[model samples]
Target: MTVSVLLFIILAIGAAGYALGVRRARAAAGGDTRKLHSLTGYHGQSVLLFSAVPALVLLGLWLVLQPLYLDHRAGAMIAVADIPEGGSLDLVLADVRRVAEGLDLLVASGGMTEDDLAAMGAADSDLKARLGGVGVALAGEVGEGVFEAARDYRHATHGLSLAMAAATIAAALAGLVFALRRIGTDYRARNVSEGFVLLLFIASSLVAVLTTVGIVASLLIESIHFFRLYPARDFLFSLTWNPQFRGGSDLGIWPLLWGTLYVSFVALLFAVPVGLLSAIYLSEYASRRLRALAKPAIEVLAGIPTIVYGLFALVTVGPFLRDWFAQPLGLGSGSSSVMTAGLVMGIMLIPFVSSLSDDIINAVPQSLRDGSYGLGATQSETVRQVILPAALPGIVGAVLLAASRAIGETMIVVMGAGAAAKLDLNPFEAMTTITVKIVSQLTGDTEFASPETLVAFALGMALFVFTLGLNIVALYVVRKYREQYE
Candidate 1:
């Protein structure tokens, strides 16, 4: 049976366990629910949790570990001599899996019988053709050892799948029996069910923590590989940005870092003032009808995809800046430039800053504004002194969030700011950021062993560190202001 089918059966069993538990509890109480320590629904929930949770957890773990075990066993079957030159075991194993899947498909399609498959030898040159006919494309000729390994892999996988299904169902049934035996008037069903719920909540929280750790660990590991191949000092401080796949590449990060900061600075410079002003207007000055209509219309910008913003930058904003400002001012005459990306990114970030700041501004206590007004302060003065100071921390948070969005932006930078990594002061000059370079480096067929490919990880790690620093600074600012306001 398939995993999904097994899961469905287990769930069905749990549902039955729930009904049995409820009936048993009611019978023990002699149909008087007041005699029971917990509600009928609590008793039912306890049974469902017991029957399904452990079985589901086991199934998840089994699914994760089974592939590793099968891969190891199948890899062991392939002889060292069978591996092609300059190709790793991973690549060969991938081919083995494809071939195994093809064989399974062939049998399922009725093109091959179990007897025919058992009688077939690796010496058959037409094996590739037969596999191809079934829609499995191999990179090269399948070796004798690889063919044998594929067959073994397929057999092992099928056997283990059945075993997994049986074990999972058995676990569910065992839990169902245990839960049913425990059902009684004196049973603490609510407490037990609530404990399971607490565990689930804790697990849900851990997922985010675990995911963050995983990302950092992966980036750190790959970045270490890159640093070992390339000098850390050169990567950090060198005033150039170029990568040659062959060798002798100048893999400097300074240029990219400068461009990133420049573009983000311009974006924030534009977005912060406009967004903050818009927030202030909407929150403190606008009428109720205007606020309702304007807020959603402004926020609609945030819902638009970044690619669409990028196209707008490329086709409209970029050229306009190049013609009207750059050429006239003799700064630079490039359609794609730092100014182009920064402006478009600023426009894109408006909703993020405006919506968040508006919420924060509105959250300020009404009493503070009343007090300011009673003190003979005008509406504008009240906003400036009372509401603005009160909402400063949250406004800072919103701005920081917008800045982070600008820093991590890739599509706008690629489309508006052309991919020319350089240390130029002119905003009208084309430039690129770390994210764009990270994408470029990892594009196409890449070998992770090489420094060029590995550098993408290093770039990502750098970006992560920079963003972390920004978060830290924002936190410190928030805490400082929040104390005074409170």
Candidate 2:
């Protein structure tokens, strides 16, 4: 069976088990809410874990090992003499699997035949007919080399699939029996099931933590590779930041750092005033009807995908600025520049800053405001002197989040910020960020062993560290402020 089919079947089994367990547990408890050992929902959840955990663990193991085993088998079968230039064994294997996946779909659809190669395109029919028509009319079942690899891979995969299925079935039976056996007089099924529920919660939380660790691990490994080629001094100082993949070139820190700071400063210029003032107005000034209508409308900016913002920066803002500001005033470049990305990114971050600050502002205790009012302070004075002071740390925390958001933004920089890695004060001049270049280095055709490819990793590590530090500081500040207010 295909992976999708197997996953669907597993999910269905888990859902059914959960539903049945809830029904049985509820019935067994004589419909007396107080007499039950656990809630019906907890019983359902317990059954889900029983049906899913083992199967998923097996599936994860299979996915990890399958590629290594396939590489081994493929290497053994295809001689070194048969491999082509500019082609890797992995690429060849990927091609083989794609064809195998196509064949599997054909088999599942019961559509296979040999047909004419030249005339097959003339047919108009359903997918099944088209597939069979192409098979019969265009070519043989598959090329000999591809066919060999596909058959071997399929045989091995099918064996594993059968074993996984058998294990899952046996485990499901055992788990059901075990759970029902424990359903007895004075049994604390609630405690037992809640333990499992908590395990599930930890499992979900671990996914986030593990993903972060994986990214950092990737960055660490990549940075090591990069540092091997470029010396620590060159990476840290020496002024210039032009990077090329060919020979040993001077790779310095100054230019990129300058460009990053310049862009960020411009973004902060736009975001801080607009976001903070909007937050103040929303929290302190807006009527209920105005708040209800305006808040979501303003937040609609956040719902727009980043790619769409990139497009707007490139097509609309870039041209307008080039024509109006650069050409007429002779300020900077005639194309994409740092200001374009900064301005667009700031627009994207406005809702982030405003929404968060609004919450923090609202959370400042009413007693503080009442005290200020009792002291004969005006609304503006109370907000500026008393409420804002109380919430300052949290607001700083919100601003820190916005700053990180600006730094990590990619599509806007790639599309609208100039790719030039030069040190310049002119916002109109095109500039590049570490993220924009990281995307460029990683995408398209790449040589994984080269420093050019590896530089992405080093840059990624730098980005991760910078963002992580920002987050930690923000969290700490927000927590400290909350404690003070409480």
Candidate 3:
């Protein structure tokens, strides 16, 4: 049976266990719930949790580990002589899996019987034509070693799946019996159930922490490999960015860093003032009707995808700037430039800054504003001195968050700002950021052993560090400001 079907059956069994557990608990209590240590529902829930949770955990582990085990077993069957020139073990294993899947499909489709499969030998049979007839296309005819391994893979996977099903069902049944036996009048079912739930919550929280650690560890390991193959100093300080898979490549960080900062700076220059001012007006002066209409309209900008904004930069904003501004001012006339991306990114970021700042500004105490007004300050003065001062930390935090968003932006940089890594002062010149290069370096059939491919990991680590620093600063500022007001 399929995993989904097995899961459904397990859940049904758990539901039945819950009913039985409730009946058992009432029987033990002489049908008087008042005599029990916990509520009737708790007894039922405890049984349900025991019957389902452990079995589901087993199922999840099996699903994750089964493929790795199959790959290891089947992969070992192929000899060194079976691997073609320039081919890796991973690629050969992929072929084996594909062939195994095709053979399964052939059997399911009634094109091949178990007897036919048993009688066929890889060295003397036309397996390719049979697979092709079933619409399972292979790059080439399967070799003897691969065909044998594919058969072994199919058998192993089928056996493992059956074992997993049997084990999970057995676990569910065992848990059901154990839980039912414990459903007595004096059993502390509520405490046990709540404690189990608390453990689950703790596990859920740890999942996020573990995910972050995994990301950092993977990047650090790959980056170490990259630095071993290529000089760390050249990667950190070199001005040029070029990657040649064959050999001698100048891998640099300066040009990409400069372009990233330049574009983000321009975006902030445009977004911060406009977003902050819009927030000020909406919070301090605008009527309720206007605020309601204007806030959602402004926030709609954030809902639009970044790629759409990139297209606007490419097709509309880029050309307009190149023709009317760049060419007339004697700057470069490229359609894709730093200005195009920055302007579009700024527009995209407006909602982030405006929405967050607006909320923070509105959160300022009304008492502060009233006190300022009673001290003979004008409305504008009251807002500036009382409300804004109270809200300053949050606004600053919002701007920094928006800045981080701009720095990490990729689609706008790719479409509006062309992929030319350089450190030119002219905003009209095309440039690229670290993210674009990370993608370019990792693209195509490049091997991970080379610096060109592994450099993507280094670029990723750099971006992570930069963004992490910004977040730290934002958090510190927010905390300091928040403490004073609170």
Candidate 4:
């Protein structure tokens, strides 16, 4: 049966069971109203929650794995001979891919004519269509082998969906049966039901734990490979960074780290002041109309794709800085120096800072603003003395978030920042970043088992650790500030 139909059956039973529980609880409590641990409503809530949570978790996990499983199984179904040769292999494969895409869209879009969907989903009603009506056409043209493979793929998809749907419905039904069996004189239905409500509370904690664990695991595995190629001391503290596999040489991380840090720092220098000022203007100074119009306009900066930013750096900003500030007063560095990337990165981070800081500024209590006004404080003094302090912790958190974003950002730095490995402070000279190196190492015709390719994972590990530390610190600071307010 389809998942929706099965779930509806389970839900029907659970609702009936919950109603029985509430009735039983009310009867037990009577008019004295002290017999049960909680009210009748709690009994109903518990039954509903107990019936749903486990089933929903199962459903969600299944959905996440479904695409991967389907793709792997489908691809494997096309053997070397069954797919034909040369150009025909390409054509048949393309046809199969199109059919798969159509099936996915059919499932997603949720409407179909019988003619479009007929043979494939006669395999199962769950599959609404196959692309180009090709599934049926394949039976003759490609012979028995290709036809058999197509049939197998269709069967596997149906089985997976059915299995997932069946499992979810079974859980929900089991919960309902348990609730019904317990519907007796003096059963603790209310307490049992409220325990189900606790599932939502548990979900938030699980998400945080899972995210931390997953990031740590990825970094740990990669770092292990990286340490294998380069010695611990040199990798961590060497003053030069050069990576090579073809000519044989030394690879030190210091130069890359230096470049990465310098560019990020420069980006932060520009982003913070502009972002903070923009937030203040929007939150305190602008009229509602002005805020409404301008907020989206500025946020448009963030929505502009990162590749577009990269192209803009390459075509415009990199050369502009080279000509304008870098070469002008002699304090200027080279055109594609630290200054170019830092400036562009700062522009990229402005939306992040402004949106976050604006929210923080708005969060300052109205009572504080009123108190300052009552004391006849001027607009500037009220905002300066009363408002900004209250919002300082959050604003600082926002800046750190922007900083972390700058560190992890790839395209602008890759395009604007030059690939030099110098440890100097001159903004005119070009510099490289950790991410750029990660990309370079991972790309080209390298074997997956080689040290050169494996080093990418190590660099990835370092990046993860760096960003994770910043995020944790920011989260802690923001939480402390919130608790004080509460």
- Leading candidate by TM-score: 1
Residue-pair clashes per candidate: 0, 6, 0, 5
> In model 1, what lDDT does residue 460 have?
96
| Best-fitting candidate, scored by lDDT | 1
| lDDT tens digits by residue: candidate 3, 1-486 | 899999998999899988988888899999898999998889999999999999999999999999999999988898887788877788788889888998899899998898888777776566887877777676555888888999999998999999999999999998999999898988999998999999999999999999999999999999999999999999999999888899999999999999999999999999999999999999999999999999999999999998999999999999999999999999987899999999999999999899999999999878788888888999989877788878888898889889989988999999999999988999999999998888888889888688999999999999899889888988888787764544
- After TM-score superposition, the amount by which residue 408's alpha carbon in candidate 4 deviates from its true location, in angstroms, is 1.4
Residue 476, candidate 3: Cα error in Å is 3.5
Q: Provide the lowest-lDDT 10-residue window in model 3.
A: 477-486
**What lDDT is reached at residue 431 by model 1?**
99
In model 4, the worst 10-residue window by lDDT is 134-143
TM-score of each: 0.97, 0.80, 0.96, 0.63
The deviation in Å at residue 2 for candidate 3 is 1.0
Error (Å) of candidate 4 at residue 125 is 39
Clashing pairs in 2: 114-136, 115-136, 115-137, 116-137, 117-137, 117-138
TM-score-sorted candidate list, best first: 1, 3, 2, 4
- The model with the greater lDDT, 1 or 3, is 1
* lDDT of each residue in 345-408, candidate 2, tens digit only: 8999999889999998999889889988999999999998888878788788778878888888
- Candidate 1 has a TM-score of 0.97
Candidate 3 or 4, higher TM-score? Answer: 3
Which pairs, if any, clash in model 3?
A: none
lDDT of 1 by residue, 343-411 (tens): 999999999899999999998888888888999999988988788888999999999999999999999
Candidate lDDT scores, in order, read: 0.93, 0.74, 0.91, 0.74
